[model samples]
Target chain A: MTGYLNIILRLTIWFLLTADLSWANIVIGVGVTILLPRGVTNVGLLKDWLRTLGEVAVAIPQAYKEAFEIMLYPHREETVVLERVKPRRTPSLIFLDIFLITFTPKTIVQRYHSRGWYEVHYIQRRETP
Target chain B: MINILSYTCIILGLVFWYWGTWPLLGRRSVLYKLHGLSVADTLGSMAIVVGLLLRIPHEWPLLVLALISLSIWNTVLGYVLAYCVTDDGTHDVGQEVGHGG
Candidate 1:
C-alpha cells in the first residue's frame, strides 16, 4: 500500500510539473516512479495512516492559531519535554509525527531517542494564566 | 470577491512571515528561533501559494504541488536542524538555561 502510494505521489508530482496528459508523458512518469529507489519497506496499518492524515488536516487550523498566539505573546517560556512515540509506528508515520509536531509553532521534536522517545522543545506564552 | 480574498491571503501570509521571522533577532535558544522560523516559512509560503492558486485557477496543479512540497520540506528541515544542533552536549546547556529562565 505504501509502495502504491509512493508511486501515485510521484506520478502526481510528475503530472503537476509537466502539466501534460499525453500517453508519452504518463509512460515516462510511470517509468521514473518505478526507477526511483525506495528504502526499506515497512508495512504500516492503513488505520494509522488515516489518523495521521486527519492530524495533518487538523494541524492547519491549529497552526494558524498558534502563529497568532506566538505573535501576540512574544515573550515565551521554553522547555524540553520527553514525548513517547506511539507503539508500532512505521518510519513514514514516525516522520509524519515529527513533521506534525514541528509544523506548529509551539513545539518541535529536538531529537528522536531510539527508545521511542522524542526530545520535544516546547514554547508557550509566559503570561498564560 | 475572489480577487479580494486572494489579496487578503497573500497579505496575511506576509504578516505570518514577519511574525515568524522577527524572533530570529532575539537572544533566544536555537530551537526557539527554529520554531518560529519553520512555522512562518512553511505556513506563510503555503498561504502565499494558496493565494496565487486562487488568483490563477489555471495553474492549480503547480500551485498545489508547491504547497505540498513547501510544507513537507520546511517541516523536515526544521526537524533536521533541531536534531543536529541538539545532538551535541549543547542540549544540557539549553535545558539548564530553560529551567533558569
Candidate 2:
C-alpha cells in the first residue's frame, strides 16, 4: 500500500515537473515506476534520501557564495589539496559517495589510491572526520 | 511579476554557464577543467529549464524530464569521464583505463 502510494506520489511529482499531463507520458511514467526493483521495502531509506537531498540543496547556495568570494578575491588562492579517504562502506555506497562528491564543485575524486582509499582533490579541506 | 522572476533565473543561469566555462581557459589540470565544466553546465542548464518552467507552466512535463535527466546524466557522465581519465589500474583490467586515456 505504502509502496504504491509512494509510486503514485513520485509519478505525480514527475508529471508536475514535466508539465506534460498527457496520458501517454503519465502511463509510461507509471509503468516505469511500477517495474522498478523492489529490493528493500524500507520507507526509512526514502526519508534518508530526501534528507540528504535537502542537505545538498542547502549546500548549493554556499557553493555559489564561495565561488563569488573566489571571484572577488582573486589573490586569495584556493589550495587544491589531495587527501586519501577510505570510506568504510560497500561498493554501491562508495560509488554513491564518489558520485555525490564529484557532483559538487568543491571536491572531486581524482583516482583510487591503495587499500581502498580514494584520492580526492578538494578546494578547501575540512578538518572534520 | 512572474516574468521578472523568470528572467532573473534565466540571467543567473547564464552567469553560471559563463562562470563554468571561464575556468576551462585557465591552465589547470584536466580534472579541474572537467570539474568546472560539468558542475556549472549541470546547474546552469537546470536553472534555465526551471526558468522556462516558470515562464510557461503548461510545459512542465518536458521541462521536468529535462531537469531530472540533467541530474542523472551529468553525474554519470562525470563519473565515467573521471574513471576513463584515471590511468592507474587496481587489479587485472587488461589496461582499460590506460587505453581509454
Candidate 3:
C-alpha cells in the first residue's frame, strides 16, 4: 500500500512539474513510474536511505553557498583535491554520493579507482600566501 | 517584487555560468576543469529555470521538468563523460561495480 502511494505521489509530482494534462503525457508518466528498474529501488534499508537523503539535502544548500562564494570572490582561487571514499555496502550508494556531491559546484566524482576508492574532486579555496 | 527576485536569480545564474567557464581556461587539471564546468553549468541552468519559473508561473510544469532534467540528466551525462575521459583503460572498477543496476 505504501509503495503504491509512493508511486502515485511521484507520478502526481511529475505531472505537476511537467504541467501537462494531456492523456498521452499522463500515460507516459504512469508507465515510466511503474517501469522503474528494480535495482533502482530503495537499497534494502529505509533508515540508511533516509540518512543519505538528509545528508544530500544538507549538501545542496552548502553547494549553493559555495557557488556564490566562488563566483563573488574570484580572488580566492579554488583547487581540486582528490579524495578517496570507500563504501562498505552497494555501489549504488556510491553513485548516490557522487550524484549528490556533483549536484553542487563544490565537488564532483572524477573516477572510481579499482582499489576501492572513488577519486572525488573537491573544490577548495586556496589559502593566500 | 517578484520580478526583482527573478531578475536577480537570472543574473546570479549567469555569474555561476561564467564562474564555471573561467576555470576551464586556467591551468587546472582536466578533472578539475570537468568538475568546475559541470557543477557551475548545472547550478546555473537550474537557477535560470527557477527564475523562469517565477517569471512565468503558468508554465511551471514545463519549468519543473526542465529543472529535473537539468539535475538528473545533466549529472548522468557528466558522470558518463568523466568516466569516459578519465578512464585510462587500466581500471575496470566501473564495469566490476556495475553502476545503475
Top candidate (DockQ): 1
Ranking by TM-score: 1, 3, 2
Q: lDDT of each structure?
A: 0.82, 0.61, 0.67
Error (Å) of candidate 1 at residue B24 is: 1.7
Off by over 4 Å in 3: A1-32, A35-42, A72-88, A113-116, A127-129, B87-101
Higher-scoring candidate on TM-score, 1 or 3: 1
TM-score of chain A of each: 0.87, 0.51, 0.61
Tens digits of lDDT, candidate 2, B4-99: 999988997898789778888888666666656664787778778889999999766677777777865787787677667666643221112211
The local distance difference test score of model 2 is 0.61
- The DockQ of each candidate is 0.47, 0.25, 0.30
Question: Of the candidates numbered 2 and 3, which has the greater TM-score value?
Answer: 3
In candidate 2 chain A, where is summed lDDT lowest over 10 consecutive residues?
A73-82
By lDDT, the candidates rank as 1, 3, 2
TM-score of 1: 0.88
Candidate 2: list runs displaced more than 4 Å: A1-51, A75-92, A112-116, A124-129, B89-101
Q: By the lDDT metric, which is better: model 1 or model 2? A: 1
Clashes of each: 0, 5, 1
